[model samples]
Target chain A: MSLSENLFYFLSFLAIFSALMVVFAKNPIHSVLYLILVFFALTGHYILLNAQFLAIVNIIVYAGAIMVLFLFVIMFLNLKKEGDISAKSVFVKVAGVVSGGLLLLVMIASLKSLEPYQLKADIKTDIGLVENLGKVLYNDFLLPFELASILFLAAMVGAVMLGKRESGERNF
Target chain B: MVEIITKIPLEYYIILASVLFCIGVIGVLIRRNALIIFMCVELMLNAVNMLFIAFSAYRGDASGQVFVFFIMAVAAAEVAVGLAIIVMIYRNTRSVDVGELNKLRY
Candidate 1:
């Protein structure tokens, strides 16, 4: 009945639709584009929740950086629709859909039945602000934050190692 | 505390994220392209991230949102490595279809 409610529903529909399109798009490039749309919708939801920092981070990290990485790879591969396996079984697809639907039903039925928690009057809304989050990150989560940098270093090394070709190998 | 109120129930976000996650699962199961499957995994991660953010905002707790920050960090690292692995596989097999990569099927 309010603008926020309307925005929520609209973003929800956009996200779900774009997600499905990401799966079913005939071209991998199209799939990547659809995925970007999904990320944008999720960013909109983050803003609606009033997590301004997360909203900006979501858009920058997800839509701007990560999706660009995906698009670069898809284009580098030059993957065509015909490059996909031509004779995929209908049964495998049906089974995947049915199994996923079952999981969705179970999760929603179990989780949605619980009563939603009401926000308290004295709740700390400013916690989502960058200043407060930076304090928490620097103070409480310092160890994990440092460890994540190590993880990034390892990932970078692994990617370089995996991507480089052997000295004697010929291009196929 | 900013006076902005999210009157939409957490249940809606939960359901929306659930549906998004399931779509991702289905995409991974049915898609043969390694890159598409990779994107689906990202989709699932985003879905979970949304739930974390929703909970964090509603409870006025910063921990959950901080956890989401860690998730995005890990996801960034993950994508770098995963795409490289897929490229290696493509170079080796000359194809990116998961069905054709049967070397590990033992």
Candidate 2:
């Protein structure tokens, strides 16, 4: 009945629709585009939840950086062939959808008993603010925060190694 | 004295995330393209992240948001490495389809 609730439903619809399109699109590039829309809808949800920092990060990392990388890969591969549309058998596709639907049914049924969790009286409501989370990230999660740099370094080196062409490779 | 987020129940979010996750699973199962499967995995990760954020907001805990941040970092690292591996496979096999690659030695 409220404006925020309306926005929430609209965004949820947008996200769900885009996600389905991402799976059903024949071209990988189209899928990437649809995925960007999905990420944008998620960002809207984050904003609605008042997680301002997470909202920005979701847009920057997912919609901006990751989707761009996916687009680049798709373009390089030129995977617009029609043959991919029929990649799986009809029976396999039906089974996949049926199993996925069963999983959804089970999760929703189990979630029906979830007791509502209220915010503690003493808990600060502004915990999602960048200032607060940054403080907590450095203070309590300092070790893990610092260690992520190592993970990034390893990933960078590994990507480079895996992507590089060997001597006399004759192919990229 | 809690900041009421919206009229929407937290269950709605949980259900939304679950549906997104199921869509990702179905995509992984039905799609033979390694790239599509990888994108579906990203979708699943995002579903979990959104759920985490919802819980964080509802419970007024910063830890959940911090965990989501860490998950994003790990996802970025994973995408970099996974895409590189996919590229190498594509280079050798000339196709990104998982069904075509039957042999482990290739």
Per-prediction TM-score: 0.96, 0.94
Candidate 2, residue A61: how far the Cα is off, in Å: 0.9
Best by TM-score: 1
Query: Could you tell me which residue pairs clash in candidate 1?
Result: none
Off by over 4 Å in 1: A168-170, B1-6
TM-score of 2: 0.94
Query: How well does model 1 score by local distance difference test?
Result: 0.89
Best by DockQ: 1
Instruction: Provide the overall lDDT of each model, using Cα atoms, as 2-decimal numbers.
Output: 0.89, 0.89
In angstroms, the error of model 1 at A86 is 3.2
Fnat score for model 1: 0.71
